[model samples]
Target: MDVQAVLKLADELVFAKTGKHLEYLEEAILRGTIQGQKYSQIAEDFHLSEGHIRDVACELWKILSDVLEENVSKANVRYILERAKFYNFSTIGNDNLTINNVNICPQTPQSPQVTQQPQETSTQPHIDLGDAPEIFRFYDRTSQLTTLENWIICDRTRLIALLGISGIGKTTLSLRLIEQIKTHFDYIIYRSLRFSPTLNATLTNLLQIFPQQADIPQNIETQISQLLNYLRQYRCLIIIDDVQMLFCSGQLAGQYKTGYEDYQLFFKLIAEVNHNSCLFINSWEKPREIAKLEVNNNYVRTLVLGSLGLAAKEILKDRKLSDEEAWETLIDTYQGNPLWLELTASTIQDLFGGSVSDFLQCDAPILDESLQAQLDQQFQRLTQQELAVMIQLAKESEPVALPDILKILQLSVSNLVNAIRSLVIRLLVEVKEEGKTTFFSLNTVMKEYVKNRYMR
Candidate 1:
């Protein structure tokens, strides 16, 4: 269902008759219609004003209508071309008409026409998932994988959270899962929020994919409604990676950047409102709205990824590291984090003659230079209160109670509450509920890194 090819043929025909090739802006506007995108979106992408874009579009449509001897506009352009027939040219000598089936000549005035011809086979599930990287290999996550599958297919979950710290295989697992369940979806779009694209930009790109809807609105609320309409109309699976980017750095968890706060209402609607489609977010931290809406329902589910166990040994075996006895200790010491293991295993192979025993004997410090650098990227975003809480947690062998932490740090109740909540949301601190009392502690990797370096 790619309209790019059809539009290219039409453009060639246009050039042959008018000596004037379609201008860059004109071409972009046409392409937007084919992809079912809105003018506001097209304008925003090209840095053109809304009024100016429409003016250009009107002129462009007039030119196309005259060139094709048919009614041509952004709305009916794709419909007309889909049903039109192409033929060899004899009208202009030496001007071969190899390209056909492009022009807006719909018969009815009631509504846009749907061609009787069946749509072409699926093309990479509607979104720009074509550039997605290969998973290479996946370890034992059969139980977790099955749970997610059931959640999407059987339980009809509209919102699913794949939450874990970096390098726990969140992205890889998503890629693998989509490949398996793509058959069930009418449109599957995968977008990365790593760059923190605005809700407007994200929706603009999204609307274009579901080309059935021609004119999306300029208003943000309208845009959300338009998306919801599509979700109800089509069984779409939208997967957004690196969703934590939407959260404001140096603030408590779930606080979005100023302009991005609309995403909270957006997520709330997606969870509470009914729609056939589902959204899967792979993030280090859950957005504030999600934390509130995450009730124990089949419709909303969250999966937290932990370390990979025995299967990680396969990595050691392939790396040709010696001493099976030391592998478990190494895995446990580092918490079997896939990325950490990959980095450390390679480092050991290069530096320690592939001897797990030698690496264990040194046991110098768990956070190597590379691993620390990775952790630093996330740690740099933490606030002063959050850092203070981490230091307090590192002092305890057992999880410390809230009152004990407040006393030890001699902090205000308000500061302690905000810091603990933020730290927990950021996945820096783990919490345990012991009857009426609550406890907090840092993970081995964080405790070791903060203690040796900052605590020193």
Candidate 2:
């Protein structure tokens, strides 16, 4: 078949499988592959990063492999598509046309046999969203949503860590994710560890969601084994929120609080073991094991959420704030956190008569009582070294390089490095990359809070 015919048939096959046409990058990768070009060549031609090109190609290949019932890769994608196209076109007039054993008819837009249907009696996927807060106004997380859907549905990632600071909306994003991908799993469960539930108790609560599980296991090991068995037997999506509550306060990030150490082993199993289920951990600070697991394993990953960018404007608009031209200034000062914006907007209404410009006229960013309390919880969790780093960063008017920080604090390199790393994990410090060097600084709200509370 010619190149156009190959591309058309490939798009059809992909649409038949995923219910969507090929995306721009996917089409680029396919076209490049058909012309026998390397990924680096494709990247250079399209003015994109080679790593991003390869990642898109990998996901595209996996999709085609599932549709064609064969291993599809950059090396053999053209051949596979040509073969499938030839078979499909030749059998168009037959009573039954099949591509890779999946029945399809080229005359129709959607094939009856290829469309996925619920197997069980209930048409809806089983969902147990216990205590998941309702997301009334979701801002633009389109890119994040797509990345997570690809990871969970396409890549089948077993374990994922959704991390961010307080008020950054980790819980909100996860809730929205459930709404988007709930149809793909047999069971979905969301639980909060805010109360610091024991591992056994958490396992029991989750197991109780399944049918035919009235009797609870007495042993912790048995409970874990049974949970794993259920995970392997059915496709499940489990989300645990407030994971930072399980860590000890006044220590480096990720140190488990007393009696919460077993959770480390449980999370490790979720990442290391073979299972169809995905366990998503949403926390202010990631578990220590995640750092090691994600480096060596493709199925394990962490997504550290940053600002909402232009989406923060929606929050301000909803609050009915004035000074449309100065909205970006307020958003930047608060670092685009939704809760922070909401609290600051309320302050503007109460004190500044809904004027953002007036709020900016202050000598420094204002941290109201509620905002300070939210930040207090985060700062109280820092170790002495982390606090020292924060104090130094708060004193700087611009982002400071690592060498300057080391010289200013007179700290051993290792100690300073670990403190900065932990602070980053906790999302307390902001990092800026300039060529080969990295600079660290605090946002306006953080700096003001530090100056008021610690550097007094």
Candidate 3:
């Protein structure tokens, strides 16, 4: 949809709800989002502070949320507007809903069950992958890739999570997979939860894509019911990325931020309830409910992504390292994380003239200024407890018992346990089993990072 068309629809909705169209700055902010401009850029254009732009966005999202009866934010407002336009043209004022290519009207019985129909192009699948990131140079993750394909295409898994640390290629893998299997669904939508759009807002944006029923549900539960109804009626592949954004920073990893806690029930229902649709999430940290529900549910699976093995040599290849023999050692030291390799490769090239051996001779210093900057961003997201736990764990030469960690930190046992758990979730700490006990240790890179920053 054109940006102007979206704004027009938004204006109409806003007028209907609040008896006023969007103000000029609101429209500008909306336009900035539509154009994919950063708030900093938008602020510069408008002679406003980035914080002020955020305030404007909050107000705009709130107003749109009120009008649409769903949470609306800069990240998702365009999608909602586009889907609402489709609803307006096709089914909003009508009574019937399209179920598996059959239009069920007011007279038809609403059945909890649905029949599977052959894939046909008669009804176009409502696809709105809003600014889905591009697949740029994905390393070999063939087995994991195949698993994702089987889960979505053959097994028809309803909810699947792709879990990994940041820059471990989750986003790129998902993009490639979506392109491969997009035709299998009647509807395809992708949204980033990076900015923590409200679950209500996300639901509304998705609901706008489906054929609307005459009596619209106002509350979230009813709205979710309507979405479930559509999921049962049509094949939807909804991909939500960066789900960790919904989680609260500076707290336990699984806990949601205020007002986002409802997302737990939302995801739980999507996993447990019957629906012909699949919900795919790409996340840095696992949600609490996902951990519990995925235990016995084959329909729900979480794939943990580790560093690339031999394929990580691709980074060295790209960087044109002078010593090919040292690539394996370099890859191991950095755990084959593409982002880390990308950053480290450059530092190696600049300082050691692309000679990995020369770099290795220096003992692979873990905390380069650039890589430390990256770790800093992730570390900043940790709670005080999590950060303190990392500090103590970094000092240990080997995996230490929970009691050892407890001895160093001035925290109660429960709090210490929670902090360690949070650290584990953030992928900052690793667990080793010795005899019957589990011990905690920081990865080499993380140890250097925490030691450099906290100890020094």
Candidate 4:
């Protein structure tokens, strides 16, 4: 088989079995193998150990066997490669396989003829939000929307917390909800506390949403009280995105030694004592004080937004593989985070032969700021040893088993276990089970971020 044909078969086999395309090492081995190099010679040329070459060869056999639905050996591997040469595999590096080129291939009497058809397009109305169109586009979370609407319109719950990791669409959902229900409120305001506003600055911004008659007070407490009074008289919806910033160690309601103490009092007053409604969206754990507020059933509601479901995947059917199984695998890798999916989908379609799983498994850059911030915060919280372990996982071609991690880190079993458990709680790592073996991988978005920032 020619080098190109061998590479194509290797790519397909790797993706079909492990949801990852051939990496640099695998590609090098395939290139050398196609040039008629023996495994030992290839190992010596690459300056790798003999065992490493044998391991790669064995893995290649397994992958090809799975893709071909039959056991593959060194002898059959060449036969499979020859057969693959007759069938063109869609690949990124080669550009000659366009639809027009397919038309000129000579047809044989026994060969079935196939024609390409134009793709259908959707006419769904796109919501535009100026420079940030994605901010208003509702990707998923239908259940959260229903629950939010019920709380606002029917139950009249005054304060709601929309909590989730970054890029899970908390801010988008809040904005979409406000666009739907703003007519019901006398005033609507969206505030981003991501810059960690102080009490004076927060109150100053709040005053802009009120009428001139609602005179601003110099004192923070008085201003807040007056605002509540106005809210009681008039229906209002206030949204605070990135509330974690406001509660960070030194600012706003998060200013107390434990972060903002008075902010908790302020929220309690707004939700329990006053009639106004507020939406708080954040990436981290809710303040302990807010958890206490759950006791007051009539005042507040909390919605933890999760990944997008099957319905949302339909929105991008025209752009890529458009296959149900491929879409599901992509979603599972990204945990259905909208920003990650959108960013990944286009790239997956353009490169990697429309293999979403392969694109995800391959190292890629994170383009979303929210995802980056979440990863930064989590990494900042780790100890040096913990960070070391994380880098090991990130560098791995696949998930690492517990024993492998210990061996790689040269740490005692207990210490390794403790580090893994800590990462699990922090949502940075996830455990995958395959029979008796357990493996750990950095969560999808985080994996790329950590690998880029620390590993390489």
Candidate 5:
């Protein structure tokens, strides 16, 4: 039962009880709920207050409850509706007809056409956005979306790696992309490897989405082969998120965990094999296979998501921040990262009454506990050398060149180069090129975090 079918039944039930159709807000709430979006997201999307949305949803549930003869809520509306649909068909007649175990009663000549079961057939793409985050408000990613759409629809890129720092909106951008171009593909499946599922388990989960899964192959090789065949047969757009979980935390970027090595092979085949499908992975660190694959195949691509730039002012605007001129300074301080700016905005709201300049007047950047905790997770994943480089950069007020870092850290040229390269890939260090000299630095927020947490 998809969202549209559920909505149709809901409208029918609502009209029968109230003699009127579902209102715009009520319909928006229902659609959002059915799609696993939160009430806050629904409110933001519809330009309504959260309290108003919640009140509307409460009234909706009460109305649905009265008609269904049971309690209905956001949590169980889908289940209750499905049960009601089944019950409605089963009680239609004394001599009931069953189709595929679902009772379909024979309609009399006088019965209305609405008594017939709705056909589920459609040309709409099969989209399974499993646990994808609801985008409350999409800041401008016009260029990014255009590039990704061109790659998938025009270039037919087989595999893409969406890389960015933590909370830089990689997942959000991908979800937005799916919304924009979902109709172009036959299948759209999103799965997260956040818990680090094994290759076999991941394959099984993905394969289950397709039909004829009554007897899945027991061998890993056969499972992979079957999935490849399906990918070739249909234009599937699969998004595997939280791919950084597949790598070892203590090692350098792109090094897989010991037992998860076979993922390397799986990804390689996806890039090399002939298929009319696109499989994109989201991660903080690029996979080891991507660099090599991009060189060998034009279809393999990588997009490193950067700061939101001027578009990020929308976030501050929603936060109701003051001192428009200071907004740019604040954004630059936080490097225009949506989540970072959001957290800092709350701090300003609480302590300075939404004055961005007041927050900036403090001796140092505010690294609230929540922001610190998030940065801690990213720092914890760095190697010792990377940590050393981060500490050195934190000590500098301005961007520093390579020779200065070498002089301060007393490290080998190759070691410094490797550490800086890894840090860049990790998106922790900021790089700037002036003339022929390259300089590196950390954003104000990160520099304060490193100083307070490590340089003490």
Candidate 6:
């Protein structure tokens, strides 16, 4: 086939299998291969990286192999082109066998006398990682982006705390924000405490990211002082993801025992002084002293991200459902979590025969015990009546106002309001204001689990 026709067919085939289009570089490589250009020549001509060109060519071969039902190689590029010509694809090559008039036969035919072969089925889809992009995908939290941006840019707010439940995209959002604002600072460092690296190891990693000619300091105190001086000398943004793993409780912020005392001191220094702008993304609440310092002192700000929004729902729309309502129901049931949405979307095509509403409304729910444990830890001190009010709101469809909650739970308004305020203080339920009225929503994933399990 002509290069244009082959490119067009490849585009259609790629979109048919994967719900995304071939990137521009992929198209250029395909056209170059059809023209019999050497990879080296193509790389130099386009001013492209040689490795990048080869990667694209490899992906193109995989796509063509799947579409043509045969192995495609650099030596057989011409053969593939002839096959395309036989399939009535337009071509400029001389080996065309009546390109426009050629009749391509089907791979299999239906006949009474013919024996048919059984089709094999597999549970997993074939994914070519070579074709995947290098960038990580962020799922949700537009409001969180704005909050982080404002804190970083505004002089009044320096240290920002990103608080959320586990697996709620805290790390992902922080990484994305850093990627966006990386150019604003001379140095940007992302350190994860998920593995609970020791103070020495953590400082070593930080040094590796931005090397200094001076020898490493011997002790944690001197090391931290030198690091702080380095950061203060240059505009830097440091992010500490999974910061909760470093601390045991909120009270003793800087009181780590034995081996971890250095880390505690590091945190204490960061909290006490304002040398560099730092962002801490964690699941648990900060230590009371740290939080108090942030609130009373104007330099630090706290931003808690909840869940995905309507825009995040659009990511699943290409999954091929029967209608928009089914899609909406699925998004609601999964709370627009990217991983959950992707997992559920893959199986949804088969579930079309089942009732979408019934599927969403089912009583069986996946117990996210970690989230439950966190909430329990936060609410263990509350009284039974207060817990009851929280449970009612957690299971409610609409945001239950104080009066409605009191009526449903058969409790006094004063008592119900107190419970609601307690929940809000603990960041269990978010109170949203709309003019004179206020509404509440449980933490995103919490709402999904509660509605699916308790309210049915």
State the lDDT at 330 in candidate 1.
Answer: 86
Locate the minimum summed-lDDT window of 10 residues in model 5. Answer: 112-121
Which structure among the candidates has the greatest lDDT?
A: 2
Q: Comparing 1 and 5 by lDDT, which wins? A: 5
Write the residue-wise lDDT of candidate 5 on 119-176 in tens digits: 1123788999888878889989888887787677645688999999888999999999
After superposition, which runs of candidate 4 have C-alpha atoms over 4 Å from their true positions? 1-136, 249-261, 296-298, 318-324, 353-374, 381-456
**Per-residue CA lDDT of candidate 6, range 53-125, in tens?**
8756765664444444444665575567567655645433322212234322222212111111111122231
How much is the lDDT of residue 116 in candidate 3? 43
Report the number of backbone clashes for model 4. 5
Q: In what order do the candidates fall by TM-score, top score first?
A: 2, 5, 3, 1, 4, 6
Question: What stretches of model 2 exceed 4 Å from their correct place?
Answer: 1-122
Question: Residue 19: error of model 5 in Å?
Answer: 46
> Estimated TM-score per prediction?
0.70, 0.79, 0.71, 0.54, 0.72, 0.51
The window of 10 residues in a row where model 1 has the poorest summed lDDT is 109-118
* lDDT tens digits, residue span 246-342, model 2: 9999988999988889999999888888777799999999899999899998879899998888799999999999999999988888888899999
Model 5: runs farther than 4 Å from truth? 1-122
- Sort the candidates on lDDT, descending order: 2, 5, 3, 1, 4, 6
Give me the displacement of residue 35 in model 6, in angstroms.
Answer: 64
| lDDT per residue as tens, model 3, 1-456 | 588877866665555444466899988988889888888999999898987787667656655554443446666778877876676425433554442244434333333222342232346667788878666677788778767876665455788988888877888888778767776678888999877889888888788877777556568898888988888777788989999888876778878889998888988999988776789999888898988998977679889888888899987898888888989988888887888888888988888899999988986654578888877767878888888888888888889999988877899999998888888877778888989999988878888888788998
Candidate 3 residue runs with Cα over 4 Å from true position? 1-114, 117-126, 211-218
* Candidate 5 TM-score, true structure as reference: 0.72
lDDT of each: 0.74, 0.85, 0.77, 0.61, 0.82, 0.57
Error of 3 at 196 (Å): 1.6
Q: Which residue pairs collide in model 3, if any? A: 71-200, 71-201
